[model samples]
Target: MNTQATPSPQFYLTAPAVCPYLPGEMERKVFTHLVGPRAAEMNDLLTQGGFRRSQNIAYRPACESCRACISVRILVNEFKPARTMRRVLAANSDIVGTMHPAQPSTEQFSLFRRYLDDRHQKGGMSDMSALDYAIMVEDTHVNTRIIEYRKRVPGAGIGDQPKGELMAVALSDLMSDGLSMVYSFFNPLLDRRSLGTFMILDHINRTRTLGLPHVYLGYWVKGSEKMHYKTRYQPQEHLTPRGWERYAEDGGV
Candidate 1:
């Protein structure tokens, strides 16, 4: 028998930086590397404990003075789209997402660049190069997938890949109990499509189909207008000091 022991993951804390979601606030993160043969199992545990994966790292907010970043996960089995959400789904009925192994390509990078240029021009990821994008999508150790969204073809079957202009992309992790949305971007010009909301709704459905119970939606800052959309998916659980608890829009359990 082999007499080897797995090394424990070493955790680290990042220095403070300007907060991306809140103004005049600084942010810090506590993180650990997710690698080795146990990566997938570790990811499931860390994600359940409110950490989010980026490449090979699993990190959570470690801000000194702020607690606005709350981890949110939707109850896939219980999710019911609101009228507006249904409208978004109907608007994007022509769009279909196909999951594929995590691989980087020039086409994805080009769309990523356009998305950053139009929607996140001043954001932290705006300056990411093609190499950076590749590393972001390809440097993971856990079970990950790249879901490419395109317009559905007239004769395409459910299992066939759609052939049309690439409309959106979601980099997601398949966890033990849920799907974690690592990142996603879409064509900013298609503003009316509401592709962002559509993608989340699709993930919920996907999770349900996979027999999973949750769709992890990363952090949702209370006052951040950019994050407010995450709250629209009701019956989600918020990570608290006590543990995951059901969140209500009216501020009650």
Candidate 2:
């Protein structure tokens, strides 16, 4: 057998589709398959350049005349939870998130199904089956983990594991410089708990505890109410033509 190195990654642009974030606009994406031995390194590089990962694909928006999807990353060391955020944390103090190896299970799928049904009933992922969910959770070559949030159960001892009702889950990657949140879902019934905001706050705290500089929140689309919440995390940086810069409220994208 002859020894040879693998070829460099080749990217492809997706066909334009109706924009989901903005009305009457089209959206395109530049995507590449993340596989092979260098997948982790390639993922890190692409992500730092403003790409987001979904399962085995790494992609970034390529919409012409539309720069709405801006990459947002929080400065973990400098971040301080706002008053509301503090309240969200206090509200969920009875809950805790434990990091577990990226794995799939029936319990996780049940929560995921419920979240999708309640939050994104018409979204593309609403119909994802359990097997598809497994691929999403386990098909990875990078350093990733699932942060499972649930009502805190009194533990037996220091070495014992937490046993709580599954309420939320976040799939994230630990990068050399930061933590990239791939995806997150929470119990829709817990409206008062504000689990969504609490999850982001927890990620920021986790990033700080890990000595990481940033916590990536994926793409924040301007003009989309769904993405506006990302701006709540103060002192965030947005990737621009001049590279990552301090985000200003006036910044449209």
Candidate 3:
């Protein structure tokens, strides 16, 4: 006859592994499951505290002495798209991103596989199967959506429009502060379009349309060229030990 609620879940840490973003360094993770009735609230707090979501789990870097991975979010209202970003917006003017429920599809997996093979073949998820990709997309316990971008089909570009083949996909979490882009990948062949930059610009516009103030871009490793593209989004705030500090090419005060 013990009608008591179960105790809240506790956090756990994982052993160190070779850091992906940096060489000659190891990385560990302090993580917890985002589950149950309180999961949404839990997720929000952890994300604000600089944790990134993966499936139903939330994790943050627990490196012993390194602080390379700093979380970043665009200052949406303050963000003035640079000349290059303006070109990206124009380049993708024919593409439309439709947000859908967090459900997996074979088409998505196909694009994901091509992306991994072309771009991140040596990364951790190189071996992820379709099932793993599905879990990544559908195992969320909080508000999540998949934004699939494709060419605007002729005659149906507006209003309940059906689309063309998928060009890119972003798995995003709807947070109280902003939209956290969990993961995104596109056809690598579209390098000229700079689909990666286009996606971020698209998200910034989407956030503005939703009246949101920021668009979370996850960690920006200090010395990684692959991560440098994130800094191009001007007027971004970097989560530092002193807290979220706004920065420009001249650095923040």
Estimate every model's Cα lDDT from 0 to 1: 0.93, 0.89, 0.87
In the order shown, what is each candidate's alpha-carbon RMSD?
Answer: 3.2, 2.9, 3.0
lDDT digits (tens) for residues 127-211 of candidate 2:
9999999999998888889999977777545455668799899999988888999999988898998998989999999999888
Error of 2 at 86 (Å): 0.7
The regions of model 2 sitting more than 4 angstroms off are 1-5, 155-159, 250-253
lDDT over C-alpha atoms for residue 113 of model 2: 96
Residue 212, model 2: lDDT of 84
| TM-scores, each model vs. reference | 0.95, 0.94, 0.94
Candidate 3, lDDT over the whole model? 0.87
The digit string of per-residue lDDT tens for model 3 on 1-253 reads 2312225757788999999888899999998888777787778888888899999888999999898998888999988888988998899888889899999999999999999999888888999999999999999889999999998887873686556979999999887877889999999899989888998888898898899898999898888988988888888888888888887746642
Off by over 4 Å in 1: 1-6
Clashing pairs in 2: none
Better of 1 and 3 by lDDT: 1
How well does candidate 1 score on lDDT at residue 84? 93
Q: C-alpha displacement of 230 in model 3, angstroms?
A: 1.1
Clash-forming residue pairs, model 1: none
